[model samples]
Target: MSALPWMQHLIVVPVLLPLLVGALLIPVAQNRHGFKFAASAVSGVLLWLLSLALLGMADGGHWPDGIGVYLASNWAAPFGIALMVDRLSALMLVLTSTIALAALVFGARRWDRVGVHFHSLFQFLLMGLNGAFLTNDLFNLFVFFEVMLAASYGLVLHGYNLRRIQAGMQYVAVNLVASLLFLIGVSLIYGATGTLNIADLTLRVAALGPQDTYLLRIGASVLALAFLTKGAMWPLGFWLPTTYAAASPPVAAMLVLMTKVGVYALLRVWLAVFGDAAGELEGFGLAALSVGGMATLLFGAVGMLASQDGGRMAGYGAIISSGTLLAVLGHSGSAVLASGLYYLIGSTLAMAAFMLLIELTERIRPPGAALLAITMEAFAIEDKPEDPVGVGIPGTLAFLGLSFVACALVISGMPPLSGFVAKFSLFHALLAMPGRVPPATWLLIALMLLAGLAAIIALMRLGVRTFWASGAVTPPRLQISEVLPVGGLVALCVALTLQAGAVFDYLSRTVDGLARSGSYTERVLGEPPVMRPAGGEVAR
Candidate 1:
């Protein structure tokens, strides 16, 4: 049930590495950009490699309990603090580190120079994210959440632009209220259950009497509200597009993973505590999650249509991604949840790449030029030139145009890409369920399709005006550092598409592990429950 002596300590490294590096950078580097960049880049790659090792360990079945629970200072769970790594947490750790590395590399090109402590803030953000994913107890979750939020506030306002400051203020205010709600909810849960450990709560919640069950549900509902706000669900998400658009490209790319953190928390809590094992309290709030997810999708679709700025449109695309994952989670099926996990990875990578691409494509426009004039030039029909053209298209234009097309395909869920495969898998899961498919599922399908259509229309419009219509375009100077990150991310998406079968198999195992909440509960409680045979029981 224990990890190897050497690997046992690696659980804490993902969090400690970033925290120590960020703190060191602040004191040692200060205004030294090169040192800061080198430290962060090295730390990020190390974190990514560590995460992969953890994933391999978890997937390799090296742990007898089917979960890796690390107790701080040898303190036991439900008493002392704990950090747990399972398939889901390990997957998230890898995803966060990969994206963090790419964003750090992209920022190294220029954004790191725009402000002081850029590397410090970035490293702190990684620490928070890694901690949030790894923490096994509710209180530490809140602690890590605050750490991430604090770092994000600094990153959001890094440039100190007027618009960024304004957006940052609003972002700060909203998250502060959410954090307050989070604390209150956690307190209520602990007061009712007499424990703040998630695995402990899983055991306690199942045995609660009717009155305590009511209180637990109330506390959980409040917690869910806080998470939904962070997840940018419909009305609570109004600030997302503006905030994302206002932030610098690399920061915006990093911020895309923040919403996924909210999704991760919700999935962990709901499945571990309030799932079918809750007996009488099973299937709580399913209807609300479904409805809210649909509404968020519709709102994001509308916003995408209304957005004139490419950056803002990309922001709306992120909102749509959140909505899709939430809606799938609401279905509460293992197959659908597995598909959602795959989609989550693909959508996040695509969105991050899109955020980077937006800035690059937008920079192609000449300053102070009107968009209308560019549209006219782009769409103008003309006879073929009498003289043969030396080359079909300029190299810079070709590169930018190809990148834009890839972004458009991924965001809009077009064919032959990871996005399309994710969507197809989701739809297949929904339809494959027994009995009549719910009207809500149909509605989700319709909204998702419409959202894709809207994204296509909006992105095509922006692309045409920015690239095709604009006259005498002078391509922006792009460095290898900047281009490599974007290319790498897009390449990841393509890789995902090609290797989807293997990816889905891993996700299926992950879903199976998660569905056996009792095993997770037993493992964290240190009881080491008997392992069930494959295809035994499935969590509802």
Candidate 2:
């Protein structure tokens, strides 16, 4: 039930590595762009490698009961803070690292030059994301959430355009309110249960009496409001598409990951604190989550269908991703959750790559044609989806067009791609549930199908307009730096498709842990205080 000694040391590196590197970059002179790029790139790659190691450790079951707890400050949980990396968090770390590295490289070509401290803010953002995933308690979660939002505020406005400034203001203001709500909810929960440690909170929830149970529900709902806001769950998520559309491409791509952070926190907290074992409060908010998720799915599909700009459509695509995962999580079906996680990985990579591609493809249109496209889109007029067969620009157009096609196929869940496999797995799990599927779940199924249809129609329309409307346009030049990240992310989707069974098996085991998380309490609280290593070995 315990991890290897070196793995114990490695558990905390994801947080510390980025924290140190971000701080180190702050003092580097602005003109030393190449140096900063090299340092940040190295740090990102290392963080990614460390994440893979942790993923291996977690999936290897070196410590499921322990889940690779680091016991920061060398003391056990509920008495001293703990950082835990399980299969789920490790998976997230890898995804974030992959996306972050892509975004960093994409920006390096041009966007980084638009503003100073871009690289520094980028590292800090990664630190916050990794910390958020690793932290095992409510208090630290809030702290990490703020660190993430703070860096994102700057990144959202990195290029300092009118649209970004306006959108950034809304994004900042909304999250500030969400943070205050988060604090209030945490305070209420702590006041009622006298504990904020998630595993500890689960035990406390099971022991709560009648009055405290009522208070706990109220507190939990308020807390969910905060998370749902950040997770872009409709109504509350009005700020999402506009902000995503306005921000620079690389930042927007990472913002896709950022939205997932909210979903991640929600799922983590919900399962840890309110699992079936939690007496009376078990499955407390499942119905609400299902309903809200369905609504969010509907909204996203509508938004995608209604969208004109590629950026906004990509934003809507992200919202659709959130909605699908939330619905699956809310169903609380173990099989479905595994499939949903698979969907999460595929959709995230597609959207992130799509975000980068938007900026590149925007250049293909000449000034007059670009203006006309905007005007036409403004009026809700679009050309019929055309075949790319006859129209061809050999170099940049081919790459950009193919990337767009791949993104389209994945996002819309069409055949022969990972998206299709993920959705298929999701439905198989949903239908394979032991009892008759509930009416609400049926609704979710319908909505998911329609959502995919909307994506295909909307994205196909957009692609035709961008790639096929022209007869003989000059190909916009693209640097390898910009192209690699987008292509890399799209390639990941291909890998996901090729290795669907293995990936799904891994995620299945990961969610099985969530289904039976009771061991967390036993292992974490009982861990002995860690002592400094002597002569290349840990002393406990």
Candidate 3:
């Protein structure tokens, strides 16, 4: 092969660029706020653009099977650390950059001013997120996971309030346990298979003898427990609402992406090692995944209805989003997977926007109002107007009200939005299967509809109380930085709705690529060593 162009190395840029910039920003003084913002903002823009290029490459089919693999230090795979990106990993990279940019802009408006090292922590988090998406080795993934978690620990406690600290402690404790589980699982797998590279594991698992198959299954189950805990499935996800509610809105918005990381890992690893290719291990744990997802969906919907606080409600909304993705992945159909990816993107954007919107909405509702309103409703009292004339809401109130409605519509999977389109596509695919729909699938369909209804009811109650029940509120002053990010996110969801056909086609292609895991294994394992500029000397 001819010498590779520098642009071919773009796969590493997403991970290395942020790591360099993050380290550079560490020594800069906090007083130099303008400098910090400029550096971080530039980094954010580059990461976004780089991700788009990578996404285009993955989708553009320039590489064989739309897969790109980078072997670090010019070493061969299954022996050296490797980085790989396909359609799914590239999609996640784009999502992370989008969310991180919005969070940076939102936080810089005020949250960064209150806290030290905010910019550095934010960039480090991005580095970890991108690294996690790219690494092909299991132990390398653990390294990136720690990098992500450590940055989040600081980011979660960014403002340093009592509530944040309390939530942060619990968050830390739970993740530590998860990390331990992750290690134990990795150890067992390594001991049994003699390799920690994910692609290599596929080869090992397929060739496993009867004795080793049992150990492989046990290790896989233990590993899944760790991912499920982070994925926020049912009983394992109790920490999400509290931590989300307590963190600053910008941080909370980023946390939404963190939760998806677990889902992404599960989807990637389970499909690679336990799908149809893995002989004895084929279809392992899928039933459990589906059941856990259903339970989580029901739990989150109920929690949304039960909670009065806006932040907590948004938190539960995140849980519902995760549940939907988990359930879909467990079902294992191409059409459903396509639609599920669509829903994942749309819901993530809407949920992040809602988390940011909560801070602004809370300003309009005075303390004790929620309690007093509940009491009045119970006692059959009314705050009736004597004249009974129409009242025009102020401009600020109008913006907040409309944004809240858009968010509610998207979250509840109502019509004329990406949320509805995604749900419609998913259900249509579910029933459109060739054979008769399973009884369990029917139950899943029913639960999904009820969950949407539950979200609608809960959000309607929130809207009534915040926008209507609490008399006229002075419109809070808004900042361009803050308002634009939220609007941008909502607008993206609207765009998703408008471009549903094209996006769905893209995702369908992605799902097709994912289903053929053979392509992934061949691309990563068969990739050649990097060529040197010198005469016929490759960096073996």
Candidate 4:
């Protein structure tokens, strides 16, 4: 049978179906708990299937070009706000759906109590996420972001605790300002270029003279800052740790998908729109990317070292990972892109698992004590399998040991794991580039190495105190439900490491398209001769 054109519906359905499902589950949830779980599970399974279908379609070489949209009522772009999907969009869709499914399944028990509409907000959030990834127009992107962020407000505040409320407020405030900036930036671009269609704007920007180029660059930079805030770049990331820390396990797990949205926007809109055309502008475009990225990485690592809370530390680690991703993007080579993509997959998986694990561990700590301080206060509590409070997960000591060792190997750029491979590819890209590996580059490498060592030592010390300390009492019993999600996530990490070659190959192809402007435009706007940066021909 021939594939139906309605296949495009698969993309929209992942977002829309969940919203509808959530609404359906609301009345039944209060009466039948099993129904709620079933709804979430069915939704998850359907989304996963859809994601797999998307992957197959992308790999089939049949994907369309130039801002694809299957409108709610068959409307077109710039008129009805199209939902576009390129390879980048497809990749993000798969990742977000997978994470959402995993998080939902892992938190099935919790959702049973938190109310059925939890799934509703979750689906609505995913709608926003998928929309953000697929939208081609700037105003639509902002609208999607608000949709997602507003839902996140509910999700983050779900537990109804004072801390959750405070954190949620801070999150709302910071992101609100960032959103305003995003709108302002988009308006400026519209004013300057007289167009908001990304493809058309890209072409017009390319045709501008040097003065107009500066205006475009300024607008682009402002736009990038808004995205940076969303992505948790340093100085703008203060709210992330608190919000993630205070949120419930499922909420925290789902939030991991949000950061990638910023990275994707930067890659899809910022870099794609600028192309080689803006790279040649005198005031450090790609060069600034490297510097900003490295700075963010260092800030994250330093914050991690200073952090005394497990959830907060995980948040910082995520920031570090984001920064590393941005730096990898800056290099703009096949190796670097491959490494960045690999790291993105692995780090996101691990971070989600770790966040859930922190939540579980939190249950075992003293009422006010954080998970990061569990070891320091271990002696106060006795291990009680019956009680839910002050009892850490059984064998968590062992898990913590394993986590420390794995972390050391991964972050230190050691052999055999995904992080090592990614860093190796990135370094190779640096070496292959024309000039020196920039003093800033060297500083980042040094900081990363140091941070890796610090993480190893800190995690080991914490593990030792919690696991083998002479006076410490054992904490509470392990939650079997909790174990499955984190373990599953860790298992994925191992699987990704094993499949590093295949992952790198896919990324290499994607990176090739990104590094060459001609390939990008041809895929998006059809084949055309183009003026490129550094006085070179990007032939189709």
Q: Which tens-of-lDDT digit does each residue in 463-495 have in candidate 3?
A: 988877887567888888988888899989999
TM-score of each: 0.94, 0.95, 0.97, 0.85
Candidate 1 — which pairs collide?
A: 378-469
Task: Please give, for residues 434-504, the per-residue lDDT of candidate 4 as tens digits.
Answer: 76667766776676666556555555554444444433345556656666767777777787788888877
State the local distance difference test value for candidate 1.
0.86
Query: On lDDT, who's better, 1 or 4?
Result: 1
Per-structure clash totals for the candidates: 1, 0, 0, 4
Off by over 4 Å in 1: 1-4, 373-389, 527-540
Error of 2 at 306 (Å): 1.0
Model 3 pairs in collision: none
Q: Model 4 reaches what TM-score against the true structure?
A: 0.85
Candidate 2 backbone collisions, by pair = none
lDDT of 3 at 413: 96
lDDT against the true structure, each candidate? 0.86, 0.88, 0.88, 0.69
Q: Which stretches of candidate 2 lie over 4 Å from their true place?
A: 1-4, 64-66, 374-392, 531-540
Give the candidate number with the greatest TM-score: 3
- The lDDT of model 4 is 0.69
